[model samples]
Target: MTLQLDAYMHEKKAWIDSQLPLFLQETSIPGKLKESMLYSLMAGGKRIRPILLFAALNTLGESEDKGLSTAIALEMVHTYSLIHDDLPAMDNDDLRRGKPTNHKMFGEATAILAGDGLLTFAFQIIASDPALDGDIKSRLVALLASAAGPEGMVGGQEDDLEAEEKVLTLEQLMSVHRRKTGRLVGFPLEAAAVIARATEQQTHSLTGYADHLGLAFQIGDDILDIIGNEEELGKPVGSDLNNHKNTYVSLLELEGAKKKMADHVDRAVVFLRKSGFENSLLAQIAAFILNRTF
Candidate 1:
């Protein structure tokens, strides 16, 4: 049977969303802090990272149960990044997922704390899981930290900030996003490979798939910023342009960006085929990135 991507996405997203609050509730955090954290964490967005983790697990013939904590932790870290990225000193956005940003709703201090809390708590979730062995936990913790930390997403953010208002070459732009966006996107696949004990050749292929998919994702986002509906996106469109940010669209033009995104999607699917996951949901997701509206 052909997999229904929408239904599959909705199911996975629902599962991730349901688990997020339960994990938060397990903590003995202060009431206000907890509330602030939950507010942003529960805010609606496509839980793509977690879904990707689950999808990777499925592709590896592993049960989704094995990746539950990892998926939740990934989402928590992603949510934390969004909360901080929307802060006054950052993107300074007012809307996120169609509601007031965390800082806008809960004040800057609380938002900052909430982001910090989520980021730190993510590692704890992985570490404290009784189901995962110590070695697995250690590996996950190291991988997650590296993906979300100064050498990865954080470093990419620094490059992005520095490149603002200045034109960047396509190579430079790719470098910035590879760390900031691609690393996290790639993390799910790598983590899944670790969990499933995938062979080195399989891991290499998945890594190749991830690199192209990550670029496709960013290119799609850049295209959406130019043409997507504000209501559908929940956040304002053209914010990239307003910020004078160099995007795939800005650097390559609208049609050029679209073509570039399509190329990456094609390459991603080829890698999936090489990894023996050609017909899996991972391939569908690459196609989704090619035509995503949000």
Candidate 2:
């Protein structure tokens, strides 16, 4: 079945697949490390983040080709985060997306460097995007940096680490998820609207949608951790409880967690609808986030 997305996620994935190798062409960097980065990146994901970026931009109804660089940049940033997340120092997982994780295939040091390389490369792509005005690109870079940097994903991760083996309040748990998950997820929405010159009102509305989507995605992941089959998930299940990482869904009853997730899903849909988005595919993607079994 074709997955619905902004303009179509399958199309975005296809475009990204074609663009990634071309962008990965080596210059000064050694081919080996570059290959390692591409190894995990190309291994395939839902590409949800980048597709969200596309939808966010498309909502402006501008048909410019300028959004492509930002789209790819977001994916690179996402890929780098995953590489680091799966390291021995972090999640320490042996498998990812039905394949050996970067550390397992390329060794931990190389995997770390590869992630670094991708992070730097993502900035390069953003700064060099010709389709967007330089000022807008700069703002996009800043917004993205905030999400990916210490105050965003990195900071959230720190919170996650500290909370482990310690009891946490509901607010603390949510704070961790917001920074860890919300910042990265927010990039597409912010970047898209910023590039498209959306009004402040529109940008703020999209932010709400992004926040809801981010929370919902993490909640779905928590549910999957308990109920997903190993073969199906391509990773171990119940790892959150196993790792003792506190998650909102973990602290709540199953029914309560499901209700919270439903609330988030409904809010996301409501925000998107109110924003006057005409994209049926974007609407469907929101539904998919709520409906996905995997």
Candidate 3:
């Protein structure tokens, strides 16, 4: 069956959106904290990480149900990162997805706590899933920790902050984003591979595809920051310039960055073809990154 990328993305995104709120309905969570967490978690975006997990599962010939808990967990972590990223101490942005950022709406302390809660709860969700065996749960937990922890997203964020106002070589910039943005983006595919019990070779191919896809995604983001409409992005464009942050656009110029993004997308497609997922929805997603508006 030919994959309709738009329909596939919509269906998977809807599934993730419905599942997200249900995970936070526990009575043990304090009402205000729950509200704050849900505020950012439900904030609208493409839900790309969770959708990628489902797409990877499908490409690996596994049922999406097998990765349901992991998908939700991934989104929680992603949202948590966004909450922290928007804190006054961090990006200091007031808008996300067309609404006030969590800190702006809930206060900085609550927003910090909300981010903390989501980050911790994400691991708990994977650890406590009834359908996964102990071994799979352990693997999932470890991978999530590595991806969201200091070695991955957190590390990249720190590097990005430190690099502010300092001109970075292209290699240096890529290194920072590989951790800050790329790790989380790559995690979905790796987590799905774990759920599907894929062979070593299959996992390798997916990981390769993920690495290039992650770079392509970041490059596209850099381009969008310069050219995207604020209404469409739900936030101000050129904030990178305002903050003096080095980006692909800053380092490579607009046209150079676009060409570099295209290069990564082409390489990503090669890995997908090697993995025999060239016709899968994952391939379509790689293509979409080339022209994404927000």
Instruction: State the lDDT of candidate 1 residue by residue for 1-294, as single tens digits.
Output: 135888899999999889899998877999999999999989889999999999998899988888999889998899999999998798999999999999988899999999999999999899988877899889999999999999999999999999997999999999999999999999999999988988998898889999999999999988998999999999999999998899999989999999999999999988888867898999889888887898
lDDT tens per residue, model 2, 159-190: 99999999888777778989999889878888
Compute the lDDT of residue 235 as modeled in candidate 3.
92
Q: Determine which window of 10 residues in candidate 2 has minimal summed lDDT.
A: 1-10
Q: How close is candidate 1 to the true structure, as a TM-score?
A: 0.98
- What candidate 1 gets wrong by more than 4 Å, as runs, is 1-3
State the displacement of the C-alpha of residue 294, model 3, in Å, after optimal TM-score superposition. Answer: 1.2
| Per-residue alpha-carbon lDDT of candidate 3 for residues 1-294, written as tens digits (9 for 90 to 100) | 234988888898988889899998864899889999999988899988898999999999999998999999999999999999988788899999999999999999999999999999999999999988899999999999998899999999999999997999999999999999999999999998999999887898899989999999999988999999899998999888998999999888999999999999999889888777888888888988888898
Candidate 2 deviates by what RMSD? 1.9
**Which candidate do you rate higher for lDDT, 2 or 3?**
3
In model 3, how large is the Cα lDDT of residue 174? Answer: 93
Candidate 2: misplaced stretches above 4 Å?
Answer: 1-7, 278-280
Clashes counted in candidate 3 amount to 0
Candidate with better TM-score, 1 vs 2: 1
